[model samples]
Target: MDIHALKRQGMTISEIARRTGHDRKTVRRYLNGDRVPGVRKRAEPDPFDAFVDYVTARLNEDPHLWVVTLLDELEPLGYAGSYQSLTRQIRLRGLRPACTACAHVTQRPNAIIEHPPGEETQFDWLELPDAPTGWGFPTKRAYLLVGSLAHSGVWRGVLSPSMDVPHLLAAMTTLLALLGGVTRVWRFDRMATVLNPVTRDLTPMFAGFAKHHGVQPVVCRPRSGNRKGVVEKNNHTAAQRWWRALPDGLTLEQAQASVDAFARRQDERPRRTETGNTTAKAMFAAERLRPLPPVVFPVVVAEERTATRQALIDWRGNRYSVPPELAAAKVVVQQRLGADTIDIATTSGTVVARHRVVEPGLGVTIRDTGHVAALEAIAMASAPPGRPHRRKERIPPGPAALRAAQVLTGTGQPVSTVISLAAYEQAAKNRNTLR
Candidate 1:
């Protein structure tokens, strides 16, 4: 409304006053038309908008990708942009550069049916790399067998050598026996060991393992980790809490034991996914898991081998000498690597030796002839001295003196003559100086 502003804006003071319906003096006093009210100038359009969405989607699809790699991909797609601009746009959008793509398919209305207590559970195996085993010297790479109740999250996890059908079934059977029942259904991935190597059209759940528990096997679609997402997520969580939670220098057994204890605690804790309901309590309420029959399966996997009388039982090339009881007789070798200490057994399952398989080279050479004499010799040496020695001290003959004496004394005709001469010196001295 200032007259100076109105004049600068090309409106006369009188014209501004008329438009604003204010007096000429007021308009002249306040007018400054160089500035507008209540409006801000817009910024330039984003430079990378054409590719920002694509870049973000690619990152979401594969979280492990690097920014440089993503930029390279964008370059080929007509993205005429700098890395800095792309980086800025990503930040401005508050994007997580490493978020996995969430499958947009929502859970069907009744996809997850809550079974009564013990009704159903899911199982899977997660692989880990070679690491040191605490108890023994050999490094052990292991697979974790994880089982969770669909409703409660009541779970059990154990480690096995690999996902071989026998090992997998053993782990499952052991876990189920410990839990006291077979759940109505078991969910799992289509691992070749468990699933009968199903081709494109055929569906084959593990016949042997499935028959043992009498639980229907539900397999997830191939390559769809999302379909079996619960245990998939848990496998990662277990890796974080169980695998990474281990002390930096712990051996594999120590790490495995630590992981087992942690998994138990995780099972006992209230599940955040279940609105803070303790899995144990929820599991107790769901009676869906069936009770196992009185029959229990053997955990020690057995293999048949012949033992030659001279052929030492070389398991993993470390020899174990079985008692003569099975010297030439063929025996059943029940070798288990991680669960328990090494055991040497006869054909009748008699434990011949219960030594732990320590280093890769420990030999259990059980000989028929006892080592009592050798042991006694060692013991005698190690025993305390009975008394201190009391011996007369004598100076040794000098090398020059001995040479001069030998030269001055001519060589005797026979060894007897030389001995007799030496005896004479000893007799004259009344002490065996030469001796």
Candidate 2:
């Protein structure tokens, strides 16, 4: 506009070109009001143009046909192009439907997270869909305690029956051992088992567990699970990739084994890192993890119960028998996380009984054979005496014994029953004399 204004003041095109450092033709175009810039077309033709129709048709057919697959088909037809170039052209032409949700989510600015090896680990609980435990049991929901190393994306997971403190701690211990070590920081969401959501404080049990592992416990912000997005994303990955097709009827131990195997397989796959593509197992090798403690944090859960007079202790709606002597005594039942056995001990820490934990709602009774025998013996020993013990059948008295009894009564003499030969002889002699 300034140049045109100068030109309107009767300046020649040559003078305007010299004054504005513009080309003579540019000056004339501006002066003549031909200001709209001409669109510059590409001088070279696109190599993908010839294959556009084919690509579009293929996309229309499947919508999700891999670009690589399409590239493979095109390569045979002399569509010489790099995969990147082919994808760029396909995207530019909008041949594929745009993933709106994905675009919306990925378009949001996200911080690029970086961590040194063994610096941080993110953990979360994934609730799996209800499935039968393969033990002829009703369908039950399982939880996966998933943990991922932030630096290497090495993941470890264990299936748990519940999300209680003991299960959570036990799962963490197992995952850390599988991961080969612990990280400097352990990250978690505001799960009640891990932290007090309102106070943002670690739960007492988890605090102790963290202390035992020598790792600092960090809780994510409320409602912001993405703070620990590494494990959170791995949770979805595990569920979709592994848990989706998990065989039915898996016991808890079997499910845990399956999860471990899945994690191992995942770690074997190549992952993209800042350095380049590498397997998690390979990267984990370089991680400077903290050595595991000599012993794992105790994940044993305990409950106190009073044994009934029948020597039965009730737990989780099932009865487990203790020693008969423990009847009407207070006992403690300790069940270690991930352990099948339940231990019943006296208040003084004497293990009186041990039985395999039964599934809920089974109405099962776990009675130790020794305990049962002890109870039977105690019952037999305390039975009253002088009572006629009933036999399988009655044996009638002989006719001679009946007659001897009648004679004794007729003589009004005290009758003494004797089994000795001398007594029998004396009774026979007396009988004969009486006769």
Candidate 3:
């Protein structure tokens, strides 16, 4: 630039080179705009270029593959480079193919949405696949129904055993309570339990549930999930931070408590806004969410449990008593939302037992007096009805065994059995004498 400026003042190239401490040829290159100031040709051939074809080919095979995983593969193939350098080269060259299916999920053009207080809450089910086997549900897939207050970004999650409609309702009720209240509008992503994605209409069951709860349901556009970005952002945070390194030995209820605690602790995190920085707890307190109804929407949330040998069925880490006769039988355990008691019924829907609810994961065993009495009577009834069987009675084999003896003796008839009374008579005499 100095050389060009000097030339613009009519200084010769030789004079400009002398003034700028550069040779005339170098100064001429700058004056002619042929040399960029910071760019220079590499003295050595690029080592990264040797692996470009391999990286591009692997990425073409799976565009969503992680760079770390690619590096692992690259190392064994003799590509010596830092992960940062490989990623930078791939990014600069646009080697990673654009995924048509994932374009909606990846970043793209979008407008920011401003939510009013108490206006909306978004709900989503984060599916945690291959969950710990000890979680005790039938399948390896576990679900968490998350609810986020759009305006305040306050979120709560309910760890559910399944993602079916009944569990969805149960979890949603619990999540709403954790959130303190219900927003006027509920946003969803066409969850099959709540909305029929084919018809784009509310399912009959969820429609009734929403009407009962007095909240309007809004399904996002077909591919525009960012409309409810609050919950989506939370889903990522939870999956990465909470579920990734989840502590072992946590039952479903224990994990529920853990995740709830995780959500609560996030309230202390600082959030920036146009006005000033604030915490979610502060904004959440200001939200004017409507009070939840006195009773939750009516839904039968049932789980199938097998009764133990003691005529008790396990539910939420607590055992509830059933009839002794139903021992080792599969029974239906149903608990209504906001109900104080849980009902244990036969597979045929006969109410066999009901137990007062207890806090979950307490390892408590609940047994009704009647059930205990019946179980005790059953145990006694199984005892010998008459006199207890004599351990050492003076008796001989009669029908079957004597018949076998007679046949062995070639008599072909029943044999008479002998009774020894001498020992008994002596014992009786001794007892009388002592008295």
Candidate 4:
């Protein structure tokens, strides 16, 4: 302010320096502004700039690809930036294209819905895309049933094969056990499997399930997902943080264990409560969740599977051998409540084969010796005794076939077949003469 202000006021450096009792170089240095304040500058170039082309190309490839996945790709490419820095740069540059088809952004009034202890729990289905095809799962989308305690934000998830009624209930039952207990009211978002979407009435089966577990069912208003905000946040967290980076070649059991561990670890993060900052585990311990039922609800999971040419049926990533006759046939697969084995049945409700359940997605092939023996016996019984006829062999018509053709044609014309040697003899004579 002293020297620079004096100079900006039209005073020379020598004049300012002499006035301020300072040297001329010092005044010039001040005028030069080596240490100016409030002027933003980057000390060094961003490392992320070196990888902008790579990130931009990747974003164009998959607009919805997770940032974590991008980070994973960038880590080995000599990019030494943090995830936040990478995301910020990507956003600032608009590398990721906007999805016009899925523009569901709308602003609405939001109110915090306070959940009392032991009052409620929210449930939702998270459909994961690009599921592991090697798992032999029936569909490309993987379904996870997530349940969260509204008060403490403690949540758990279970991966299921499908979103049908029985599978949904079975997964919900499993989630209840994983969550430690059941709450008084179970909140849902009008999932068709659980209730009527228009009527908002629980299905008879789901009502029975609720009765069996002694919990109330509450359906949220249409499109009001934030009514169950706790579970909604958890859904995003699980998908972005955990599911995006799932390791390859993991068995279904291993994946479930991994997610369960992740959820349990999340309970230790600090949470804001009525009293003050506390942990989810501490608050959950104070929740008054009711005990689960003595036995799981009778939700028999049944699915239709097709037998392959090798008489094998695909079920939950494992192949089970059926009778050879059932090859190229449709069969029913059923697993009863509390049962350790899975049943392969006929359309007529007859159980044809049973195999003990194993960890899914391990690519295990279960075979019954009886089925194999039957297949071999049938194959041998129908075996040919001699070598197969040549595919391109000439089979000229014989006398019997000629007579049959003449009789069918109502004619007695004699068919002649000969190879003339006269032409060859004449050709040989011509060659001899030329020699």
Highest-TM-score candidate:
3
Per-prediction count of colliding residue pairs?
21, 1, 0, 0
Residue 104 of candidate 3: its Cα lDDT? 62
Q: Name the better of 1 and 3 by TM-score.
A: 3
What C-alpha RMSD separates each model from the true structure?
15.1, 24.1, 15.4, 13.3
Supply candidate 2's per-residue lDDT for 40. Answer: 47
Predicted candidate 1 versus true structure: per-residue lDDT over 343-419, tens digit per residue: 66676777665544545434445432333344345557866877545587566899877766776787423234323
Model 1 residue 160 CA deviation in Å: 1.9
Clashing pairs in 4: none
Which regions of candidate 3 deviate over 4 angstroms? 1-107, 130-135, 373-435
Minimal lDDT window, size 10, model 4? 100-109
Worst 10-residue lDDT window, candidate 3: 103-112
lDDT of 4 by residue, 1-435 (tens): 766677779988778877999888766765787655455557998667789898878877778889999999888888787888888998888889976544553444566787889999999999988788755567888888899999999999999878988998889988999988999999989889888776777888999999999999998877777789889999999999999999888867778889999999999989986679999999999889999989878878988887998899987678999999999898999997777799999988899999998876677999999999999988888889986789998889999998989978979667669998999999999999999
lDDT tens digits by residue: candidate 3, 1-435 = 676678889999888878888999888787777888988868999898888899999999899999999999989888899999989999989999988877766666777788989999999999998788766676888888889999889999998888889999889988988998888999999779888878878999899989988989999887778799899999999999999978888877888889999999988888888999999999898899898888778788898888888898888888889999998889999998778899999899999888898988898999999999999999888877688667887777779887788789988965579999999999999999999
Cα misplacement distance, residue 365 of candidate 4 (Å)? 5.1
Superposed model 2: Cα runs more than 4 Å off: 1-107, 133-139, 302-333, 336-342, 345-352, 355-369, 372-435
Ranking by lDDT: 3, 4, 2, 1
Candidates in order, TM-scores: namely: 0.51, 0.52, 0.65, 0.62
What's the true lDDT of residue 9 in model 1?
82
Give lDDT tens digits, candidate 2, residues 1-435. 778788789988899899999899987876676664554446898667888789888887777789999889988899888999988998878889655545745577878677888899999889887756343222477678888998888898976666888767777877888888888998887778887867877889889888988889887776556677778778888999898998866655566678888888888888887678888889889889988998756689766677889999776557899999989989988988657789999999988788998875455788889999999999889878867657865778898788788786795455579676998899999999998
How displaced is residue 312 in candidate 4, in Å?
2.9
Q: What lDDT, from 0 to 1, does candidate 2 have?
A: 0.80
| Cα deviation of 282, candidate 3, in Å | 1.7
